[model samples]
Target: MKMRFLAHFVALILFPCWFVSVRAEEIKSPQPCDFKALFNFGDSNSDTGCMASAFYPEILPYGETFFHEPVGRASDGRLIIDFIAQHLGFPFLSAYIDSIGTSYRHGANFAAGSSTIMRQNRTVFQGGTPFTFEIQVAQFNQFKNRTAKFFNQEKENSFTKDIPRPEDYAKAIYTFDIGQNDIAAVISQSGMEYSHAVISEIVDNFTSQVQYLHELGARTFWIHNTGPIGCLPVAMPVHNAKNQSLVAGYLDLNGCVNYQNDMAREFNKKLKNTVVKLRSHYPDASLIYVDMFSAKYELISNANKEGFVDPSKICCGYHENGHHVYCSNRAIINGKEIVPGSCDDPSKYISWDGVHYTEAANYWIANRIVNGSFSDPPLSIAQSCHA
Candidate 1:
């Protein structure tokens, strides 16, 4: 396993150059940014293992595609965060909550599965994790302060390589990939009356959080807007067609609920505006807002062209008869025996389970956005630093 990881590490270091195209002018980075670390904040989309570590560990087939074992990720393999780490020539960011063997030299991830931007009126047992975006930020503050304290102590010298240097904080990449669950939760509970006020509040909370991170020394911001939730199989199952009458006329050709997509777009619009506002307020900060909706929607709408199969069909778990048995769980659904499973070809599928994307799909999205194709300033991830 060490040999395999070493090979990957060497490959990344050898091939670290990426071209940054600026308005028909292609500029090559002599080398990637001297980004010493990365501090991430988000939900399941970028979760390394926070939720699983704090809760139950994901079983086999969760990390089967890449790790050959469950490493507590909610996917079949690597996530966009993983690709981001690989691209930046850093080891994967360890979850802040997962203390076992976690080395945070490159930075720490505060994301957790099903985390929301604001506190919901439910428990972790209901759906999302208890750590809201605000809580994650608080955790980041604690991690930073505590690590600083440790560094000031003599006996903690052993953590020189496991913790970030004081100067590295300003050079770290702060990536955010949340808001999908918050919006989904709202729409699920409130139906078409999905409160824009709630969406506004979430966006405001997101902006505040980013500003806090910036104040904490994050200079380069890589923010991802919510994806097209309308296309998610988990959002609208075929068995629940009767319940989709509200979106019957709004359904796109590919069967995605356009109204839900519109809501996502609304959220993205507000988010983009907030980014613009932030950039204006903090000119020295590179706040890159990524259009994840277009990146994901394109893949889903044109899956065949991308060597992928059905866009809505999942690579893991079974959803039928208005019942869903998750990837690693088995149950008797509608008188049929359900077993834990996944598709034979995960690389050819868009979604992993009904909720999360497959590793292949994740890689595709990461590849596109990293090049600045979907970014606001059209700056590649390597050139995201304002410094």
Candidate 2:
């Protein structure tokens, strides 16, 4: 009887120690999951409706696939940013320009279609005025100031009211998907010879913009690099002659123009290096570089595996010779109103409107981004937001 009691006592003594160790480990590996907001900045890739609100004003065929009506998205469906917001358990972010009745409690999107990193007056494909990176940052600063004052007023009016604290800004995620338009502008206006210098300027401007945000109390950044522009149906027709002779030898296995993809790769490399430097410079910040190129490339390379019938062809665009002839909302043909057409099966096509990805492709990429293995430092959107 005495020996039995002693054995029980020994186990009791060790059990407390074991439990304490396990709990300490859990405490050390704190998985944060209470992110309250998401602030986004970028170009058409992430623009929900800023451009549409400003210029197009809910044009048809823009958001026909997903929203069933035009909601300002550049694609036939949702953009990658929309999926990210949905994955993070937040409603679609409202554009800063269209925040009249919207709640900013979950943050706002300052991105616009054709926005460039540099502070230049650039027109996007449809001649829409772009809100450059500088302009976006300025808008963000304005938002912060305005929100802070409003919160302060609310707190003063009612101490019992649950108001968002200033520290919440630090916990919010700031995402960027700009720089593509900048590269595209350079390629179209200045040719490939000046691309290196333009890309350098782009990186420098991007770094500066990040620094500005960091100064404004943003600690978490999710920056996306430029994607394969040359592969887009819009780009293929424009740059085909530049490398027509080498097309047979240089095109990707998926049939995308290699020269444009090469340019995208170079930009990604430099952006990656720039992100590394930013990490070192701001050791306390969570600066993540999202590899959008690889994500899109994977979808293109494994289209069949992903249940996509055509990765290169656009789901909604002008048709010519059994291929996409670029995307446009309307074209005047013989004085009649002819609109851009859509494929019967968008779910089976990767490209949407020749430039953006279909809703299916965006969902897949967003799933990969938030589920892990697509971001640098290897953190998913869920983990990043929660952290």
Candidate 3:
């Protein structure tokens, strides 16, 4: 009792501003989670640079809106993972494959562009990451094992400057924002019928990775359900809808492909159930399920009302006939080399290049999600510790 009172007295003396809050439990602390680091696994939605480093590096107009140069992110600016890092009061995570400007002091990102829960294809040339969820899980294990060796030898290792502390592993937050590409791949390769039926298998693959993380000493997990791929302009062309050849259904109210959105909705439902099932399996862990579908759907469904152009509009890239020219990519137009380039103001748009969201749209979605409105446990990122 004396120690508790003395600690309060010292706090009152050191900080007199909000120290005298009306109630002890009412304080909205910055990070009640107090997560030491962030370890993320996902696709392009959360990928920082792994795919770019291993495959093709981006150029101008990719990160022009924020970084003023290519930094490997597909968006015009930061992604939701960047915003989540800010909410955690930590620096943005570095890709495990990107060696330059990297410091694992906070954590590392194993996400890659076009990643899927189930293994799809090899390399960006093949159109998706070979680094599937299980592969990323193996990479994470390797990282954790190797970094620990360097940290243990810090006394003799001058290169241990940016390595994460050994203790932070348990105190870190592990996030997953993948699984969209899996459905897309199946839909493109097979048909809508197989994609609809294979959702359970997809969830099963995702669950195995989470179980591995828990076994590897991961305590807190933040899982984001897949978003509305039906709304993406890049995804629209792939849909059999426009031609009414594959799935016979009209576009939804939001001008999105109905079948694609249905796939995302079904995936989210099963993913949520997977989280619930895992919570019982790992009684000592904190598994948080965040509903990214609703949050992203909200933005896409109301892009114009929130001071932005149509959600289906592309801020960067050009479509010449059937060939799509993404931002900073070269194309021969009329027998001339040309880059379609980006818009004059990316902030006014939602989709960055017909696929990913712009920094503005990302920020808007981040604001709504970090507040806990879409979280399964109904807790903000800051308050995820309890959940």
Candidate 4:
């Protein structure tokens, strides 16, 4: 009986992996299309080369897994933004601080790691300049400015005198992935009441930001849904209790934190509905909402069931209370020079630190997006190449 039970358990474990691999193999690769450039906005999950350099050198350890050094990513390696750009056959968009002579003929990255949808959310998240959605619009204007100069230089050399208008100079693929920080910061800084208010109030602010971008000639939009917040390790200590953690509120029939998980669901539902309404609001706008929430849950929930050993704990964190303290300094621990600890193979783990995913996890989510699994009505970026 015991041997048969073990055999059944092993088969159950192996089946999901085989299933996911087969599904991955079945996905059609992206074909090159008509988008001249790609522009990214929002927080760290999509930030490729904007956050780490602008903030702190200690950010190195965070990207050590895949990048080997700080490449201005929030995770330990490539982010979803990089994957999307690569899928489109464009070079990784240069950071504003990089001063590299890259072809902006495509677009530029305006994403900053701790950015928010609302300007006020910055103060709530602690340090750094508030690269609000409004500011991202301004950065797009700068990109348009640079593209105009490139065209004007070409015109100066030719006989043609037709100047490209701002609209003509702008041909882009725009992505917005903000708002989680705004929701998170509300709880981190203000009371829960403020968090609830932010949940309701930011809908209009988000709509306005999208509308503003549309007015600026941004037509191809990839709006990402909010990622799972209750699952983050940082929240573990914050929501800890004697009997259980707030994360317990997301469990299925297993006495887990279903209620907390539902909070994330509620947020995604509203955002999804808003996307539907926004599509109706602007007939010319081709806005696609990407549901990262469900996909993130797919990777995170039962992480142990998916080959990760430690789901509740971070790779590097304070051992006492399960809190994250910067593990930057290579100090002596019991006479050995140690920077505390880091995950052996970050690719195997879904999370890098307490709050974010490993590069491999980001790749998985991007693969899901590219495969049209994350999109409503399944609109792949490859399909929008003609847009």
Candidate 5:
């Protein structure tokens, strides 16, 4: 009974077509400023080279577009965070595990391919192990420690007599992108059949994860609500399972699992409220919530405006059944094993591999974030991006 109630609630709340009007001007970009460094955290979507170098299935097609060879991104080229850093005048962050000294000084990326914003063993899907939000925060703590040591040594050598200044700390930027994996996990694993108590517990734990980041000097928060999960190649296959003999247009195509999507929306709503509640506790804190769902929807629904075709289909996949073998898989023949083909132009598609966005899509998202379209009224994206 509780499970059914939760499912009904999700269906009602997560449907994107039903939106309330919040009249406001489109947010604008802030006057550009320089930042010494950037740090990112999230799943494969935001991973630059962490997973590509760390994991298997290494192949040319991985980073073939931008690097003309694999550089460890889930996409064919750069990620949104990469663009954000470059836009701000800093070099792209090196992975935390990278051995290069100069890249390490620019900043470090803590993002892993399958990370989540929850502490539980909840996965992004059936067989994926995500570094929980708690784990990601831990990685940040490590980065902070390393940075302090590096800067501390620099100050000692340069100043030889004075204490470290606040300006030194201000030079670095810590950016984050997560929460989608959590919603995806709930949909794929629990499937809206869990008890309300279970759902509530999960939400509670998630809220705590955000609070943890706050305590750790995470001043600038770039939180993204889940995108249209239901519309993805994976979710589309699961949506409307009972509606057989139906045309493709007949499916409930709101982009995400209804209940889980609602969970994401409600999480965003409550998160905004939570941020308000937290301001008193952390006065200097700056938190910005990006409505990734709405942004992606506008891009996809009005593809012509963005000059894109189907945002639904990925650029690379198994020709058969569209079951979606790994994007970098070198061997995928006709229902067998052999080298496959990648699209000539990945930028034309929103999705690069089945599960991640193309460099083009990430660029568009970064533009919206800079433009302030995703920001709450009055505060603005520029204020938050630099906050």
Candidate 6:
């Protein structure tokens, strides 16, 4: 009788505390900045591991700096997208193609290296077929459908609770960092004379993709403009070689190929205008244009000031005669396997493999991009998340 009385006394004391805790939770409301997921699409600039997952025999020297091993990322370390995820308190996005023990609770990365905005069979530098932006969008739709069905099945089976609602996907942040490969392909195939026409076509395709994504419940958009491709070590040698007579006049004082930079600027202008149009059309949505050109140009123009000793020189490459040898883990040179050499300090260099930026450079650019100045709508990504 004494034991039962003691148990009743304890229950009476704890019951009110438990009820109050439950009531407090029930009264709490979700905050504006309480983002639940992130969805990304682009090329190598933001590809976490989509390329690696699609192709086997993962390349080395790609993720050596940050991950300590290759994880299919084009750079030596994390990309700007990775930094964004970290800033938002989320783990790195899992590549959609990664089928082995992957989680979709946070989000998926559909970005692939050498991916183009246009729907074409354009081959990447590594000879792998790219999954274009159109395909990525389709894949996202499929993912959504599959996830919804899974949630429904779980509900019917009484196996799980707290399934994501439709609004959750609509509220998720959608980021795009494509179009570099499209311009590069045009320049490589038909010279800079045809870039303006190609840029128009790319913009049309890009805007259409945004509309399609909006229809699929994406309300927030973060679009990245193409960076200065002409200043790349690989492109500089090619530009100088092709325009030998015009090199002296066209090259910048900093020795970067200026004509190519001019093309990039023109493309960025069009892209910015497109963003304005998108905002006008989708008044309810948050469409932000990230100024990648200015962010990158600042680094290039003030390399010394930014603590980078060599902004023009690539961190990893093979030394050759008046040409920048592309960085690769394994390459055949006269039937001999050759490995590219890397600098002792990659942080002091802007370009990593003649095309992609080093981790340090990406970090710097990401900081600028998220600090509100580089965004067109005059709001940082963090603020947009809150909005």
Highest lDDT scorer: 1
Q: Give the range where candidate 6 is weakest over 10 consecutive residues by summed lDDT.
A: 154-163
lDDT of 4 at 257: 42
Q: Write the per-residue lDDT of candidate 5 for residues 5-46, one digit (tens) a residue.
A: 998688668963443322122334355434555667777777
Q: Which window of 10 residues has the lowest lDDT sum in candidate 2? A: 154-163
Task: Give per-residue CA lDDT, model 1, range 7-69, as digits (tens).
Answer: 878866776452222423554453557898999999999999998889888998899899999
Ranking by TM-score: 1, 3, 2, 6, 4, 5
Put down candidate 2 lDDT per residue, 44-127, tens digits, no spaces: 888877887777675556677889987778877888999888888888888888845555668789999878887775332334
After superposition, which runs of candidate 5 have C-alpha atoms over 4 Å from their true positions?
1-34, 120-127, 150-167, 190-192, 195-203, 238-260, 319-322, 330-335, 377-382, 385-387
State the TM-score for model 5: 0.77
> Between the candidate structures 3 and 5, which one is better when assessed by TM-score?
3
Winner on TM-score between 3 and 4 is 3
Q: For residues 261-304, could you state the per-residue lDDT of candidate 6 as single tens digits?
A: 77678778888898898888988888888889888888898999
Candidate 3 Cα misplacement greater than 4 A, ranges: 1-31, 121-127, 154-156, 190-192, 237-249, 333-338
The numbered model that scores best in TM-score is: 1
| Model 4: ten consecutive residues of lowest lDDT | 157-166
Which regions in candidate 6 have their CA more than 4 angstroms from the true location? 1-32, 121-128, 154-165, 190-194, 238-246, 322-325, 330-337, 385-387
Provide C-alpha RMSD values for all models, in order. Answer: 11.0, 6.2, 7.3, 11.2, 12.1, 12.5
Candidate lDDT values, in order: 0.85, 0.77, 0.84, 0.68, 0.63, 0.79
Angstrom error of the Cα, residue 234, model 4: value is 1.9
